[model samples]
Target: MFTYDTTRATAEAFAVAAPIDAPVSRGRRRIRELCADCVRIVLADLLLVLYRLRTVGLENIPTEGGALVIHNHVSVVDWLFVFVACPRVPRFVMHYRDYDRPGFRWLFDAFGVIPIAPKKEDPELLARADRAIDEALAAGDLVVICPEGTMTPDGELSPFREGATRIARRCNVPVVPVVLVGLWGSIFSRKNGSPLSSLPRAGRAQVSIVAGPPVAPGRVSTAYLVEMVTLLRGRHR
Candidate 1:
């Protein structure tokens, strides 16, 4: 089952801050950004209607400024859920393979998702991703990353990778932990077999998304994130 955080610290940590720095010049660049926001608004509305999504701790998310939004990966559409719940349109860090997929390449391109690969496979690409993340954060853009790196084979939360922590430390940004529950057994999840092979289960699935307090860059770690996410997921029998 999923759980919510109601502590005073969590509440105080997310007190709204002033808007992020908007240094973009007027003209094509500004117009493009506005168009993207419009698309996200439409998509978020559609998702809420289709899945009946429920979100908690939205106030825990800072309204503006740079943040490393971290979440446990469960379904292929997990990012979509997080995007809908967030106050800002975050640039997601995606696996290069997923970003290169023919069918979805356009979407990734349009959203400016950062594509990253394993260091061993492509050190250059990894370096580029790091630089991109740093630049985005400096520009006051929230960046979303799935710490698990890949989807979970089962419903259990996997150990988070170090990338999220490293990025937060490098960029000096708060690491916000968000968890998506009730996604297992869905068509986008690897419940019965390969994901997407089976038809969607009947009825609108009830999904609970909880956002935890932002962990400071110095205090964030893989183990800490794992524990926080596990607590958020709670005991599912």
Candidate 2:
């Protein structure tokens, strides 16, 4: 059987990087959850076969309760790694442009994804999307958002927006900061100005998903999150 180790050293480093002490809620899920246990296992195995996949601090993901997950965006496939590693199937807050793309709606719909567009594009649409996110959080669902808004054109982390902070504050939920390592030169990343411009790595490329303990809603901020993700990523591009 193929397996991976989540060493205590890694967990400790992540904890010290972002000190956190928040209550975990274990409540019955009120909304439909996607990615059943079996599906997650299968996807994880597939990822393992495709890359040198390593994860740390998954336990930081609350077993039950509404929480906001913030992560640095590197590639188009960043969500796949987060989905398989999280303890629960999280409702992804994705860009409407990507979520509404043809051939992807089926998958996004299955997970009850909340799609948001620029307020200038359609104020009503944005309002509805916000309402949907609120309802999902109230139902004790985990929601993941990339505050950078889009995948990075360069390997460096982009300036984070206030969306995550707003959600965590309004919903009164913990904010879990996550970082992805070693996805910079991937085919899906904008490594050379545009995605697919660069060739993919041969064999299994080393990748890591480091998830830190949840930050209290009161402590969540754009600058704080940027610092936490930067500390966790630590020299990895």
Candidate 3:
């Protein structure tokens, strides 16, 4: 394992401040390191310091109640914006590899990461993920899923994965479609299976986050979901 963090990489690492999902009254005691709210506030500040970005349609995120947010994956730190834009408290089930990493342990617990295996459809991993989704839904929390399996090296949306569909159907929740553009164009964009290097300076990267109304669970075919998201994502491209 490397002894330090890679510079100009798109990987994510941060702590949360407040609990957008659950709040504790003044008369009650709080759990250890439960600082999601603080994390959000800090993250907002950190993002501004790290890169220049433009977010649109964030208001579409429901101001209240549970929501399942689906977005195209680009930069690894893109999740920071998801938390910032979301109105309600948020939690996301992430790629299992992220949670399994040693240094990423803080990110998993600090930001409430849910383990999800994509490259390998391990039954055990699926079972754990299913349980986590159920608990999140039961807690009336917003669910953030990439549904694209993994981050795209070429800075484009990947084919939508089916696991998110299965979870949304099982939980009977509405799916919010979102389009993320420009996070990867920054120094954060990772190497495409080659020596790590930053793209030529583009005078700060441009990014857009568009949150559309939620799509309720249905019997729609996978092709339909793919087309719907692709078209919506194209709106800003």
Model 2 earns a TM-score of 0.83
Better of 1 and 3 by lDDT: 1
Ten-residue segment with the worst summed lDDT in candidate 1?
11-20
lDDT (Cα) of model 1 = 0.76
Find the candidate with the highest TM-score and give its number.
1
lDDT of each: 0.76, 0.77, 0.64
lDDT of candidate 2 over 21-44, digit per residue (tens): 112223212112312343456677
- Cα-based lDDT at residue 109, candidate 1: 54
Q: Indicate which candidate wins on lDDT.
A: 2
From the highest lDDT down, the ranking of the candidates is 2, 1, 3
RMSD per model, one decimal: 8.7, 9.4, 7.9
Error of 1 at 84 (Å): 1.4
TM-score of candidate 3 against the unseen true structure: 0.77
Positional deviation of residue 186's Cα in model 3 after best superposition, in angstroms? 2.6
Clashing residue pair totals per candidate (backbone < 3 A): 0, 0, 13
